[model samples]
Target: MAPPLVSLRVVLLYLRVLTVAFLVITVIILSTNSVTIVSQGNSMKFHFKDVYAYRYMFSAAIIGLFYAVIQLFFTISELATRTKNPFNYQLDFYGDKIISYLVATGSAAGFGVTKDLKDTFLALVVLDSTDPVDKLFSRGYASAKNKKLSKHQSP
Candidate 1:
């Protein structure tokens, strides 16, 4: 049977890589997302900055990505040296929990705002079912909103 420490180290590294990958994906999705609205021959573009929640979610993803990368570096170094540092362990424990909560709150805020805008306000106030431009705007809004929601799934 494989040693427990080897298994633990492998799992930890895998999860760290996964976290980085997800954060990168979240950043890419949120950063590139935009919505365009054409009304009465005037066109307006909306981006993540238009919504504070999305901005917050994007910031959290960026910060989390940095933290994950740093942790991954340390984890790799420790594994290669076959040495353990209690201080690093403590930092990892607290950092992981704090980042998780930060990202969770960001996701929740983004989700709530997106839900309200897409389901409640936009449906009733801004969109006209008969207008093709409005349909395009709605679809754009939905795509941006869904991408923002995906940030919550990251570690």
Candidate 2:
């Protein structure tokens, strides 16, 4: 028997939960960092010397948090609609990946601009490691090669 079709409402609800979770986490982290930065004063020597640097960092964090939340929503929506809608499913994976990359890149750029070298470096690393097309193509090529070898061996 075929698996039961998933509901879009269920998916949307899940997305909503995920978005809330992300927001909560982001807020917690930002608040913690803010407190720490304020408390440490000049004791915590950050790379960014200008007052504008702090503004940039806060802005970047908020933007990154929002981006992450939105991405999660899209992913949930995609999964929810996938069985009933193959086209939407196809778009979701690529679209989410692209959006994620953009968010990461933007966050990193913001960090760089804000002189948060550590954050910038980490973002760059993450962006470098994720290549959906390369992974998909390589897996396909390997599977095809394996199938060809198996066919020859059977004959």
Candidate 3:
């Protein structure tokens, strides 16, 4: 019969796989996002790279993905050999907590940026504008940030 520890390891492996996948998906989504706003016969474009918070979030996701993949490899090796090392236990203990913290901070930064923009610039511009074109402009502005915030749910 499989031991309880083995079952735990299996669950951990599944979680690590999920973490890695989600990080990758989030990174890809953030990379390709762009928004174009037109006001007063002028158009300006913005991208995730244009924002420092989004860049930080992207970096965090990448770092988390790299660590999650390495951890997955280690867990797989441990499961295959049915051997437990003290070093591996320590790493698993600290690594998970650290990565989670990083992801949380990244998500927070993105959320902060989104909220500030939505409440401040977005509201001001959209509310002050009576043009129908400005409504689409407002949606575009919000959509870009919303996409970043949504992708953050994975980790």
TM-score, cand. 3: 0.78
User: Sorted on TM-score, highest at the top, how do the candidates line up?
Assistant: 1, 3, 2
TM-score leader: 1
lDDT (0 to 1) per candidate: 0.67, 0.39, 0.67
For candidate 2, write residues 1-155 as lDDT tens digits. 23433454454446545544543443343333321122213322222223343344335435545654564565565455554356645554564455445434433443444344434534553332324323322332332222222110000
What does candidate 1's lDDT look like per residue over 1-155, in tens digits? 44677677777888788777777777777777676665556666777777787788788888888988998898888778877698887778788878877777766666677667666545554543335433433443443444343332212
Query: Tens digits of per-residue lDDT for model 3 on 81-128?
Result: 988788987787788777777877787777677667556665566432
Model 2 stretches astray by more than 4 angstroms:
4-20, 35-83, 103-155
Candidate order (lDDT)? 3, 1, 2
Off by over 4 Å in 3: 124-155
Candidate 2: pairs in clash: none
RMSD of each: 4.3, 16.0, 5.1
TM-score of 1: 0.79
